[model samples]
Target: APQIGPFSMSDGPANSGDMVSTSCSIVKGDFPVEILWLHNGEPIDQGNQDITITKINKHMSAISIESVAARHAGEYTCIAKNRAGNVSHSTSLTVN
Candidate 1:
């Protein structure tokens, strides 16, 4: 089985127009694990201009949002999975 490490935010509550980032790491997961980001329980599109995913390393990844709006405030989830198993971590983003 694999585990998704804790979710972390680059900063606390963000104001409208502020840039924010969130990240999670994979543990005990096989290589080529798929990493997905969800906002308010919905998958974030890779082509979205406001949001972007960055691969920090083999086991670490991050999602960044530019000029966050009120709608960006929601529960964010990081899901890491492979053939063996899957794991997830969630955190909340508050925008003012």
Candidate 2:
């Protein structure tokens, strides 16, 4: 399996702080594909962010980031897990 996420994060506003939403995707299965976000190397919480997913196929899924801010700028990942095993991937964010 292949894990992909974070994709990219872009800064918002020149003199003010704003949200920097991003997105990620992965494969779907009978198990859960854990889409996790990290800020400054810390794991993000579900209440702080909304994780989106869709059944692209028997083994495919999707995710999204909304109202992301500078604090939300960091590495994001998606862990696809099943009875077989698990796989994960991450990406970085830059708010400048």
lDDT of each: 0.83, 0.49
What tens digits encode model 1's per-residue C-alpha lDDT throughout 1-96?
568877666467888898888778887767788888888899988788888989898788889987899888889998888898777889998898
Query: Which candidate's TM-score is highest?
Result: 1
Number of the predicted model whose lDDT against the real structure is largest: 1
lDDT of 2 by residue, 1-96 (tens): 444533554443322254344555554444455444455556555554343344454344444445444554556555566565666666566544
Look at candidate 1 and give me any clashing residue pairs. none
C-alpha RMSD of candidate 2? 4.9
- Model 2 stretches with alpha carbons more than 4 Å out: 1-6, 10-19, 28-34, 49-68
lDDT for model 1, please. 0.83
